[model samples]
Target: MESVRVPLGERSYDILIGSGTLKDIGRHLKGTAFWRDSSARTAIVSNPTVYKLYGDTVYESMAEAGFEPVKVIVPDGEEYKTLLWAEHILGKLLSAKLDRSSFIVALGGGVIGDMAGFAASTYMRGIRFVQAPTTLLAQVDSSVGGKTGVNHPLGKNMIGAFWQPSLVWIDTATLGTLPKKEFIAGMAEVIKYGIIRDSEFFEFIGKNKKDILNLNSKALTRIIKRSCEIKAEVVSKDERESGLRAILNCGHTVGHAIETVTGYTRYLHGEAVAIGMHMEAHFADMPQKEVARIKRLIESYGLSTGLPKDIDEGALMAAMEIDKKALRGELRFVLPETIGSVKVLPVKKDRVLKALKRGG
Candidate 1:
């Protein structure tokens, strides 16, 4: 297994990545001092679709380790990630008679992890939570980082907290169950890591797109581990995103806007991000050749670089204006300086609108 540490003082945690790690979670967590007591309860929060498939196995394994496993099954989809859904899970924790000593096991994709992590962060003023990310998007991106939140009707993840998980467990084997479109969506964020931090990694992805899409074990393992490493290094320096962590949002500003405009139904998170990256690249100051290269690379992966068919440029711009990264009414974007280098730039409304049109 490849491991990366997110250093956040006392809140720091380790991220473990490899195939079949899920089966060993019991061993990995066995005999911990925190669970030495007999009263510690562990709650596994997931959606129905995921829980029906893998929850019993996980629950049985953890139960063998002596921790009472409780299940909180949430409804699937981005629409379910709301304060109401979080409250429902929180109510479950309350009904379970959980205390600060108890643990939360987020055992699904990004939505499950985010809602569960948020519940853990707020329940009893905060408790330990473990991330068992099942999707490629969750395993390589959201699962490792501590950022947790639900979307508001106004925007995506507009309401969230910087609550880190105690540990992140990624089982690459889980990717086998993911649909082709979902797998492709994840490649968007994986590609983002390379675009913003490692030119060589970017080149590698450009070369191995086929193997990656095919779920080749070696290629998937390398991408997930490397992506986690980059995220860990960044979060270690800026856990609260006061500075360096902004680089992680390379395509998120416009991406989030796209999600909101489409009512979170048109595209998956990474698909929206893929389109966002293309538009951001157009706004970049790089030479036309570099811009074309980035576009081609994204397209080669079967990702979309064009705006949604029915989205209006004006509405998209309006959403971007209220993005969290905006400061004093000026929009800030993480734009590429080169394949491996990115910096946050404050862009004007007119310029952003122009880029949106170019993307359209």
Candidate 2:
């Protein structure tokens, strides 16, 4: 198993990544010292889809470790991430009689982790939660950063809190059962890490495309570990997105707008971000050739670098204006200066509209 430590002083935690780590989850939690007394109950917050797949193994493991555990299942899909669902989870935790001492284990992908962590943050003021991310997108990105929230009608992640998890439990074996579309969508995030910080890592991904896609064990481990490391380093410096952390929003500005305008149905999170990255690159001073390289990598992952024709450009622009990344109605894009480099600058609405048209 490979572990990456997210250093947030007292709130610091380890991201444990391995092939069969899920089976020993209870023991891992106990080792954390906080969970040493397993008499306290745990709520495994998951969706119907993910719980159906690995629920038994996780529940049995916690039970073996002497934890009083119950499954709190949420409906599956990005659409289900909302304040209403968060309320449902809080109700379940209350029904289980979970106090601040109890743990909330988020046992699915990004959406589950976000909603479950949101509940853990708001319940009893604040509590502990574990992020056992199942999908590649979750493992490499959302599971690490402590950005927990649900979508609002007007924007994505509009209502949320910054609550770090006690543990980010990742088992690479789960990727084997992920559908091809989901797996392909996840590569966009893995690719984002390389674009934002490690040029050699970016080149490494380009060279090892086949093995990575084929689910070769070494390739998966390498990408997942490196991505976690980059995010940990960033989160350690700026835990609350005051300045340096905003760089992590490379494709998120436009990406979130895409998700919001489409009502979370058309494009997957990674897919939208892939297109955002491609379009946002042009807003930077980078050479056209560098932009092409970014586009090629996105395509190799079976993602599009262009906006869908069905989407209304004006509505999409309106969504961006309301995005969290925007500054008082002004557009701000984390535009790439080059591969492995980016800068966040306020963009004119005209520039954004031009980019949108170009994307089509």
Candidate 3:
């Protein structure tokens, strides 16, 4: 197993990446300060589907380790990521008699991880939480980052915190059950890392797309580890997204707007990101060769580079106006300067509308 440290001083944690870490979570947690205290309780927060599959195993493992665990299952889907769901989790933590010393285990996809992490962050001002991310999207991206929150009616992940995780357990074995579409969605973020910082990784992904799609263990492990390393480096340098971290939002600014406009049902996060990348590329100042390379890589992963056929261009542009990245009523975009390089540009409203039209 390979471990990457997030380096947040008192709030720092390690990300464990491997194929069977889930089965040995007890051993993994045994060494952490959060678990060393015998009096600490743990709540395993997950969704129904994951609970049916691996929840019991996790619970049993913790029980065998002499830790009392309470299980809380949230309904699946992005729509369920709300204040109501967070309140429900808070209620469960209270009913379980959890205190500040207790820890939360988010054992599912990004939605569960985000909500559970948020619960841990707000419970009594801040408790401890671990991430047991199961899906490719979670493992390669969301699971490692400290950003946690739920969706609001106005936007995606609008109400959130920068609370770091106590530990991140990435078990590649769980990804075997992930549907092809979900797996493809994750490739969007993986590709984002290459676009923003690593040209060689981009070429590697382009060459090994088939093996990656097939879920080759070695390939998946390398991708996950590398992606985490890249993200960790970025987050470590810019914890609160004051500068360099903004590059990570290469596709997220417009992507989140897409999710909000569609009510989170029309496209998955990475799907919207895929479209966002395509549109951002059009506005980039990169060489034509690099632009073509990005386009080819995105298409190679079976992701759509176009907007949804039914989405209205005008509404989409209006949505962009409200994006969190906007400043002084000016649209800010993370656009590529070249493969492995990007910059945040303040785009004019007219230019944004034009980009929306092109994307649509």
Best by lDDT: 2
**Tens-digit lDDT string for candidate 3 (36-117):** 8835578999999999889988998888877799999899888899989999999999999899888999999999999999
lDDT of 1 by residue, 1-360 (tens): 888888878888888888876777766777666446535588999998888878887888888887787899988988899999999999998998988788889999999999899998899898889999999999988987688999888656778888999889888988998888998899999999999999999999999988888889889999999999999999899888899999999989889899878877878889999999988888888787877777888899999898865789999888988887999988899999988999999887888888777663
TM-score of 1: 0.94
Clashes of each: 0, 0, 0
TM-score of each: 0.94, 0.94, 0.95
Ranking by lDDT: 2, 1, 3
Task: Please report, as a residue range, the 10-residue window in candidate 3 with the lowest summed lDDT.
Answer: 31-40
How far out, in Å, is residue 65 in model 3? 1.3
Provide the overall lDDT of each model, using Cα atoms, as 2-decimal numbers. 0.87, 0.89, 0.87
Worst 10 residues of 1 by lDDT: 31-40
